[model samples]
Target chain A: MSGADVLLLALGAVAVGAGALVVTTRHLVRAGLHLVVCLGAIAGLYLVLGAELVAWVQVLIYVGAVVILLLFAVMLTRAPIGPADDLDRAAWPAALVGAGSGLGLAALFVSAYGWRAVEVAEPGTAGLMGDRIFGSWVLPFEVVSVLLLAALIGAIVVSRPDIGAKDAKERAR
Target chain B: MIRPVVPFVVAALLFGLGVYGVLRRRNAVLVLMAVELMLNAVNIVLVTADTTVRAAVRDAGLTHTGGVFALFVVVIAAAEVGVGLAVILQLYRLRDTVVVDDLDLDAEPEGAR
Candidate 1:
């Protein structure tokens, strides 16, 4: 057990804790902040693992781009930032039971496969990762770009007032 | 002395807490946060694997797929945030609310069920 590992474990704990709070809370704004904390932790874990490229990606993509986009959308909608919104319903028992099973299943999977040790290679930097991503997974990588484009288009269509008018035109009797 | 196990345990615990939050919270935004938490927990494991696994059988000089997988996850997370927020925005416009409890596609309107 090295000092690096211990620090990571503790960071992981804090990250998880903050993330859970993000979900459980009723305030959407707070939820976004918590997500930042969670993503930050993941970045830390990436650094600890010696996957520096991945660590930076986590921060750049998640913290920098994704969360910022989320905040923008939230602000665009002008979501009531106060604690007025109801976070959950009265189905606490069912929710608890479902979540418990999810944890149980994950634990079972870990126990089943965890005992077997897999070989690990040394970690590399951004240059190595770039070669691999651009080399090995180029096809799926390009396809995902198209997919994201489609989603962006879909979002625009769904939210634009013109779409609403078009829907009304179709529905007009 | 205690290294791998602590981080691993912490990751698992984070995953558990994330699941609990997702199941319990009706807020869509919060649900997304929980999902992110779970993803982070997985990344922890991926990182641990990268650092800890024996160096011989692993190929490409990186033990775990941490770098590769994390990179993809980042891309996917971007797309997810984009699409998810768009949907949420549309829903808010229609219903004037962001509460997940208020959303129901199965209620079956005349045009779209």
Candidate 2:
């Protein structure tokens, strides 16, 4: 086993461990923090896999933006930072299903591959990624941008009430 | 050389853990967090596939398609989360609570308000 392989395994462990903590922890804030750790470790795994662009973008988008947004939502809702008695329900069923599927899938993958070595190519560079996105995948890229815009507008519409309605109610009073 | 199966299995487990959280957690925000974990798991699988395919094909253009697919998934996931959190915020405003059990899809009587 090379040093790089060892590093990859270690990072994978960190990511999986942190991910487990993200779900199991009682404190909401701590769960979010553990998510950060898991995401960071995933980014590290990406780095080890030689996808530098994906790794950095993972950090920037997942770590920098999404998580902060989550924290903001948590604070805005004023949810209990600590664990609540009723936060979890019917844990045994969920555990059985989750673990069973997880292990089942793992076993399937391991058995299928059977300790075979997969070739590791050069990490996809930004240049190559850009070419592909702009070249062959341009339409999907544009559609995603449009989707993001629609989501933004939809969020604003759903979260805010109509000013005219409020004004009319005030005038009636 | 790393065994591609390793990362793939880990991702599968992550997805499972995500499923567990989504089903067990009553808090809307925690459910969303669990969804994020699932998305991350998908990303790992996609990128790992890209690496393996790239190594086999030796064609730079064809191999990175997995990466591109993963990229789009990330973008969509971000948008989904944005809209989701907004909806959750609105729910909190209406009910003063974010527990999933408290939400009702059925219509109340006109005079209930």
Candidate 3:
């Protein structure tokens, strides 16, 4: 294995471990923190895989935007940052299902690939990504921007402070 | 040589953990967090597959397709979380709790008041 492969393996392990912690941790803030770690490691993995644009995008979107949104939601909702007695349901069933699916998928992958190696090509650079995004994928790119706009408007409408009043007025009629 | 299967396997496991969190977590926010994990896992697989294919076939057009797809997924996931958090906040406002178990699926809205 080359140095890049080893680094990729280490990052993957970090990602997997931190992802597990995101689910298993009792503290809500800590879980969010773990998610940061998990996502950061995944970004590192993306870097190792030679997708520089995706890696930076992962760091910016997942680590920066998404987690901050989560933290804001957590605080705004007044969710308990510390351990709550009822935050988790029964553990055994989840564990069993999770482990079963994980191992099953792993086995399937191993059997299908059987230690086969695929050569790593030239890395996907930002410039190439931009060209393609503007070239053929422009429609989807524009669509995503529209989606973000709609989501923003919808979220504001949905969470409006006057929603209860509107509901009450509708109910009275 | 970097085996493409390694990343694929890791992606699967991450997805499994995400499924576990979604299934077992009572907190709505936690479930959303798990959903992110699942999304990331999918991204990993896509990028890995893209790399392997590009290496083997050497097609320029097909080169960064998967990466671009993954980028779109990330963007959409952000939008999803934004809307999701808004819904969660609304639920919290209405019910004063974020626990999924605490939601009354069958309860009448009129009766709730």
Candidate 4:
């Protein structure tokens, strides 16, 4: 009914649609591109929901970094650029589960809050989010930074086989 | 005033689609992409919950927890992707294939024994 509500619905539709394409597309590279669109649309949904900081962060991280990483992986793995026939497994079970959960969850939500309107919160700006992150969330924030550092080191070690080969050989001996 | 159910439904459906993709995709990278979809759906739910529960949380002096959690999820997802890709690339190096079905979890490498 309201402008924000309308925007939310439209963006949600775009996101879901693009997400479908990201999954079902035959071309491997195109799936990555579709993921970018899907993520961008979700970012728009975040904006409409008044999460300005999260929305921008979604764009910067998901659309910008994650998708690029996926694309690079796809290329590095030498996925076929054209349509691949064996990209999908059997569909019946997947379709059944997908539709079951999707529709079932939708039904549950609708039944729980059918036509119930709630007041939107104040838009979350960067400053407010920053205060919360650096204030109460500072500990967890540092932990996450540590996690990132570990992941970085782990990635480097995993990718480069020579890093620990000597140690593994010594241990084996 | 937007209905909370709308976004909730969207997120649920997205998660379901993610489940399907994870099950259906043969490629390792595509499976990872599906996992990303599921994570995004969770983020949407978190942000929407922030709006719906803002009043109650503001009274408790803890506003924006959901949004902050969502941000943390983003950070975690980035890390997961980094490490996941490294593992996948290593698998590709070892086997020259990235198909999930081609991977045999129980089988030992030819020279390891």
Candidate 5:
């Protein structure tokens, strides 16, 4: 009914639409791009929720860096890009049932526990989030940093592309 | 009327789409995109929660504790993306195909199971 509601709705539509494209599309590269749009919409919703820090970080980490790396991998390894029906067969039934039930359960819980409440917080700044992250959430902070380190190492190991080839040549030698 | 619910509605649709993509797609990049879609859907829910709830999480001058907890979540997402992509890349190298169907890592000898 109000302006804020209208904005939230529009942004929400964007998130869902982009998300659908991320799935239904056939191309691997295009799907990654769609993911960026979907994530950017989530950041917008975060802004509307008054979580500016989370929104930007969502863009920076998920949209900016993560998607780029994914695209690069697709390009480097020559992943299959055909439309010949290359769907996953083994876990299809299980995944559909699990995800569907999970979604249903989430809807029930959210409506029951969260729908009626009025939020107290508004959009926050990087400084505000920074203070909290370093102050009280220090343990998780350390863990994530370590995680980033692990990911970086993993990226180097996996995406190197030359490692396995080099090993083959070494074995031939 | 149905305005505030728009974000939630859209996010649900997106979540469903992500599920389909994750299940149907074979490319690792597309699979990662599906995961991103799911994350975005959750982010929508997170934002909705942040807005609908009454808290001082946003206002630093009040209580900065809860906001810090939220920051932990964001940072964790970042770490997840970084690590997950790297691992996917490695899998591609070993297996040559991102499609889950081709992954016969344990395809040999029925008794091996």
Candidate 6:
């Protein structure tokens, strides 16, 4: 195996392991921390795969914004900092399905592309990504901005019950 | 050259773990974290496919489709988390619990009836 292949495999191991911990760990905050590790490893995977922009974006968004938001939610909800016994439900069914699908897909991938090696492409730098985004993906980019706006408004509206209550009171008057 | 299947298998396992977390976790925030896991798995697949498949199809019109899609997925994930957390907070306010199992869709709110 080439150095890149070894690196890819190692990083993938770290990612999957951390992801497992994220799900199974009883500590709510620890789960968020584990998610940070998992996402960082995946960002490394993206870098190895020659997607520099996507890798950094993963780091910026997933590891930075998303994980922080999750940790904040955990704190706001008053979840236990230490391990909690009631975090998980029965294990058998979840384990059965998880293992079945994971192994099944792994087997399928192994069979379909057994030992096949592919040449690595040029790394996708920000300049190239920008060109593509502004060139062909501008419409979708605008749509995403709109989506973000809507999500912002929706979140604000959903979290504050007084907004709805005020409107109802005004209508009743 | 890296075997393309390596990343594929990793993504598959990650997704499976995500599924397990979603089903097994009682906390809604934890469930959202699991969903993020699944989204990351998909991003891995997309980035890997962009690398391998683009190498093969050198002259394809849209060479960065997968990477672009992965970017869009990231944006969508951010939005989803924001809205999701808001809803979760609202639920916590109303019911004082974030346990997924405790949520009953069929039942009306105590005052609604």
* Worst 10-residue lDDT window, candidate 3 chain A: A160-169
Clashing pairs in 1: A120-B63, A121-B63
Q: What lDDT tens digits, residue by residue, belong to model 2 across residues A101-162?
A: 78888888888777677656667678878888999899999999999999988988777756
The residue pairs found clashing in candidate 5 are A50-A122, A50-A123, A118-B52, A119-B52, A119-B53, A120-B53, A120-B54
TM-score of each: 0.81, 0.93, 0.93, 0.96, 0.77, 0.95
Measured over the true interface residues after superposition, the C-alpha RMSD of each candidate is: 4.0, 1.4, 1.5, 1.5, 4.5, 1.5
Worst window of 10 by summed lDDT in candidate 2 chain B? B104-113
> lDDT per residue, candidate 5, A1-173, as tens digits?
55666777777777767776667666667777777787787777777766777777777877787778778877877865664356454556645854684477458655755534344344567876677666667687788788768766775766566667767777889
| Candidate 6 per-residue lDDT over residues A25-93, each given as its tens digit | 988999999999999999999988989999999999989999999999999999887889988899989
Better of 2 and 5 by DockQ: 2
- Over A1-173, each residue of candidate 1 has an lDDT whose tens digit, in order, gives 36765667677776767766776676778778878887888778667667888888788888888778777766777767788446776657745664575467557656745534333245557777777777777787788788878878877876676666766777884
Clashing pairs for model 4 are none
How far in Å is the alpha carbon of B59 misplaced in model 1? 3.5
Candidate 5 achieves a global lDDT of: 0.65
Interface RMSD of 5: 4.5
Record all residue pairs in model 6 with backbone atoms less than 3 Å apart, i.e. clashing: none
Clashes of each: 2, 0, 0, 0, 7, 0
Instruction: State each model's CA lDDT, in order.
Output: 0.68, 0.85, 0.88, 0.91, 0.65, 0.90
For candidate 5, what is the DockQ-based docking class? acceptable
Model 5: residue A6 alpha-carbon error in angstroms: 0.9
Give a tens-digit lDDT track for model 5, residues B33-96: 7766666666666555445443524554445343455555566666666676677656665655
Question: How high a TM-score does candidate 1 get?
Answer: 0.81
Q: How many Å off is the CA of B8 in candidate 5? A: 4.3
Model 4 residue B106 CA deviation (Å) reads 4.0
lDDT of 4 by residue, B1-113 (tens): 88788788899899999999999999999999999999999999999889888866645347888889999999999999999999999888887889999889787655331
How good is the docking of model 2, by CAPRI class?
Answer: medium
Task: Provide a comma-separated list of chain B TM-scores, one per candidate.
Answer: 0.80, 0.90, 0.90, 0.90, 0.70, 0.90
* Model 2 lDDT, full chain set: 0.85
